[model samples]
Target: MDGEYEIKKAYASILESDFERAIEWFERAVRLDPDNAAYHYKLSVTYARSNKLGKAIEHARTAANLHPDNESYSYHAGTLEAKQLLQDAEKYIDGHTQPHLAVDLLKQALLLDPLLIEAYLLLAVAYGELEEFGPALQAAKDAVKLDPQHVEANRLFEQYREKLKRYLRS
Candidate 1:
């Protein structure tokens, strides 16, 4: 009964656009029903809407773990993790000091979301910088396959094609 009341308050707070209150109520509901994956997922969504990504990821992960068969929960957790990995990869790229680190991070991101075109594009660029032409070209090709009209992917694909041609000729 208490859990139901908390869920009702949480829903009402969401309708009112009071995300902070919604989170508070949702947190209470989750505590009252720790095994309730739905409660955890709802808390995760509220945290996401509030732009508290860390908390969102945590709760989303909890929900997904509790209900591994729930595709929606798992998908949300994967997406959140991928986004965080992408951000870390960008930081490594910006530093210009660890292309390998960025590549590793981006690889993890792509593993989580294979169709992430941006991750493929960035991965291709990173591989090119490392002179791993085969994988680089493949990644570029993958990006183009995922989104043919993606301007940067197309550019990268052409660039790699030229690079391979020159290498073979030499």
Candidate 2:
């Protein structure tokens, strides 16, 4: 069958909420049209919906690489990358003894998605764990900049600022 036919089948499967079948059809479409960015993007979306982030990131990157001018493709790829990095950062944070590693990952994620308020908030937490109050205050401020109405960001910023002031006084 043609790639178009496969895509139609994939969409139909999605309408039926049969994600596994949709994934199968999308994979077939990708195989048939390896160079088609749209096919790769669709496959990437499907993979993400199925909670297969690794494959989703692979296809998203491929689609963006194949069509550099397509802002939608690049944006999706960057967001996915940022999300994966945030997850890794969260794992480090959960360890409680690896705040430095989480800080690094969170920084990378923020670079990719500067508007990611969650990353900034998590970064503030990591910096606080490391007793780096200055950076923690800055991260909290950034989060507040991204979302002025975020209560947690405001609270963290105030808390870190106080810590930094106390450190300076000593």
**Best model per TM-score:** 2
Q: Can you write out model 2's per-residue Cα lDDT over 77-158, one digit (the tens) per residue?
A: 9988998999999988888979999999998998788888899999999999999999999999999988899999999999
Scanning candidate 2 in windows of ten residues, the lowest lDDT window is: 107-116
Q: Rate the local accuracy (lDDT) of all candidates.
A: 0.89, 0.94
lDDT of 1 by residue, 1-170 (tens): 54899999999998998989999999999999998999999999889888788999999999999999999999999887887788788887777778899899999998898877888988888888887777889999999999989899999998988888888788
Worst 10 residues of 1 by lDDT: 90-99
For every model shown, what is its TM-score relative to the native structure? 0.82, 0.89
Cα lDDT, model 2, residue 88: 95
Evaluated at residue 82, the lDDT of candidate 1 is: 82
Q: Which stretches of candidate 1 lie above 4 Å from their native place?
A: 12-21
